[model samples]
Target chain A: MRAQFVLSEIWIGLRRNLTMTIAVIVTVAISLALFGSGLLINRQVDQMRGFWEGRIQVTIYLCNEVSANPQCQENGPPTEEQRAQIQTDLEAMPQVESVTYESAEEAWQHFSERFESNPALVDAADPEDLPESFRVALHNPQDFNQVASAFEGAPGVDNVYDERQILNRFFDLLSGLQNAAFIVALVQIVAAALLIGNTIRLSAYSRRRETGIMRLVGASNFYIQLPFLLEGAIAGLIGGIVGSIFIVAAKFLLLDGMQDYFQFATTLPISELIYVILLSIVLGVLLCSLASFISLRRYLRV
Target chain B: MVGSDTRHHNLREHAPVINFDNVTKRYPTQKRPALEDVSIQVEKGEFLFLVGPSGSGKSTFLRLVLKEERPNDGRIHVAGKDLARLSNWKVPHLRRRIGCVFQDFRLLPNKDVFENVAFALEVIGKPRRFIRKVVPEVVELVGLEGKADRMPDELSGGEQQRVAIARAFVNRPMILLADEPTGNIDPATSIGIMKVLDRINRTGTTVVMATHDAAIVDSMRKRVVELEEGKVVRDQSRGVYGQAY
Candidate 1:
């Protein structure tokens, strides 16, 4: 009987304030969707960082016949003695975890394999154009400068390049995007909360007569406030369900497109997206419930 | 008549169902206290009339009994429980034993007669079967029998007041507080409403009615407690709304 009464009350309240309810639902949906997107973006950045952590390296290209650098061109190709000395020096450095020499032929093969997804790009490159280099794995990716500075103008060196620098720039851009999403989501959530609070206030005002009678006849605070709380909760749940659709759409349209464009960047799987969706829904429900609870506080004081 | 069969009769004969001792209530916005150092005792099964002008603390007295407002000083005891010591959570339990009727009739406009009366039971978590059985009987008792399906707006002013009375009496509270229940209805209708309240009073329930209707008070000849400016000025048994006023 109580459940029926509460349900009926919720239905009545929702129907009575249809426009406000719809406004609350739409606001909550947009807010939770942005929230979920923020979570997904954060996850994507983490995944990319994890995938690249082990593979990042600093490459030192030797002075070869076809090199464009003034140091390499003037010196021509490094002698065998110069190559052995550079290799020994890199191996002795504390920051260098490991060093491996790649021949021009091997470099060509790796480049071809890396760009195999785009056969046209791989076919445009020649084996003779590739340079022989030492790929240095560092103890700490942040310590790339230590290795780069050591061999920058050393004999046989054409140019020293650290993959961390390029990867950091890319990760910085993703982090900025993630922060923007969070800030926007925060604003949306505040708007949603205010809307929820107003909806509850309007609902409470419309039902003041019932609540006054309820109080007179000995209805507990919970008993009197249950229907309003349920109204907010139902609005939140509906918003969450709608937001999940947005989240799924974002996964398919936004994240998937990103994955396709940046093939090496790892994006979230469906399972993780499902988790984020559930979390967003729960957050939406909590936000609305809290807002309504706050708005109904003065009335409950009786 | 709802809990007549199972109602407890263990209280001593001298014990009052409602007791207020030197209770003073002041609103922060108002200069004078609403009820200043006023006190009264109402025994079980008594029909009492609280008569006074508009701002004589009649409503405030009823609110204090229901623990709806806390007294600024002194204490109130209802049904042998000290209201000042009662926690906020226990206020509802205290209210369950005291039914309140208002001048406005305070009926939910959207609900029908039957639903309004049943609302009292439903809010307290009464079973559907029990509500079904008791709501009709109380509706009939208040003389709203066949009009159970009519909404509050559809009913006459008198009938609306009857529905409000039926809702108050449905819980079979030990103390019924009526704040000008007849204020909005005609004198003839007010008499009928009084009869219903008198009947409920005879059923071993204490009825405290605050009213401005002199004719009804003079005719009923019940206990009359008259207030003036937040202080009790007259206490008369079988009073006639007092000729001095």
Candidate 2:
């Protein structure tokens, strides 16, 4: 019977402050949705970093007939003896994890296969014009500059290239996007919290007469404040469910939408999205409950 | 002080349900204390009137009994428990034994007569079956039978005050405090309200009413405690409203 009374009171309070309740719910929903999106973006960037960082290598390209570097023009192409000496020197270095030599013909073969979808690009390239390179995997990818400077002016070496430079630019852009999402989500969460507080305050003020009567009739403080607390919880739960739908939509539109253009970078799977959804829902409920508790403390001491 | 212990023991045998000892209450914003060094005792089952003009400290006395305001200088005891020593958690239990009626007839505007009365029981976590049994009986007791469904705005001022009285009395509290229960109604209607309170008092509940209605006080001829400037000026059994009587 007491539960019934409390439930009825909650219903009455929500109905009385329908507009404010809706505003709180919408704010919570938008905030949680944005928050979930931020988490997804963060995970995506981390996944890309892991995928790229593992394969990062420093390559040493030998001078060929079509080489454009000034060093390559002066030295022409390296002899078999110079190439063999260069390979043995690279293998002797402690930072070198392993070295694999690729001939000009093998480089052309790999390039054609990589761009097989673009036959015009394959037909435009010639095998002899491609440069033979020694690919060196490092024990620590950050030691690239040490190896690059050692091999920069070496015999038959055209140039030493670190693969991470291009990848760093891409990651930087993605990290910026992730940080922007988090900042906006933070602002929205604050907005949702304030809206929840205001809604609870207005509801308490409108029902001050009833609450006064309740106090006169010997109602405990918890009993008097129960309905208001439940009103906030109910709104939060609804907002969370709404936010979950937006999260799923965001995953589809934002992540999967870019899959065709950036096929090499993997999108987050369903299980991770499910985790975000559950977390967002729990956060929404807790935020709203805390805001309501605080507002009640300030407005209704009873 | 040695003989006082036995005297208090004897007093406990038929203890005054409400006791005040040199109680003084001063609101920070006010120039003078609302109640100053006021001492009074109200026995169980007594119908007492606190008669005074506006700002004479009658309402403050009621509020002190309710523990709504703490006395700055003295002690108050209701039903053998010291109000000063009572913990906040136990306040609701203390309040459950005291019902309050106000001049505005502070009935919830949204609730009808039955719900308004039942609300008193409902808030205290009374069982629904028990509420169903007692609410209607109390409603009829206050002479509100067949009008249980009427809203507060729909009822006359007299009827609304009766609803407030019924709500206060429904929980069967030991003490009923009425702070100008008849202040808002007509003189003819005020009598009916007083009769309802009188009936409730006859059922062994102590009644403390603060009112400015001299005619009703004269007709009732009850114990009247008059206050002037926060000091008790008269305490008479079977007293009339004025000194001329």
Strongest candidate by lDDT: 2
Question: What lDDT tens digits, residue by residue, belong to model 2 across residues B39-156?
Answer: 8999999999999899999999998888888899999999889999998877878899999999999998889999999999999999999999999999999999999999999999
Give the residue spans of candidate 2 off by over 4 A: A63-82, A85-97, A116-129, A138-159, B1-11
Report, in order, each candidate's fnat: 0.74, 0.66
Model 2 is docked with a DockQ of 0.65
Backbone Cα, N, C clashes tallied per candidate: 0, 0
Each candidate structure's TM-score, on Cα atoms with residue i matched to residue i, is 0.91, 0.89
lDDT for A175 in candidate 2 is 78
Candidate 1 structure quality by residue, lDDT tens digits, A173-204:
87888888789899999999989888999999
**Candidate 1: segments with Cα more than 4 A from true spot:** A63-79, A92-97, A104-131, A149-158, A265-267, B1-12, B243-245
Tens digits of per-residue lDDT, candidate 1, B1-245, equal: 64653354434566788888999999999999999998899999999999999999999999889887889998899999999789998888999998888889988887899999999999999999999999999999999889999999999999998999899999899999999999999998888999999989989999999999999999999999999999999988899886655
Q: How many angstroms is residue A141 displaced in model 2 relative to the true structure, after the best TM-score fit?
A: 4.1
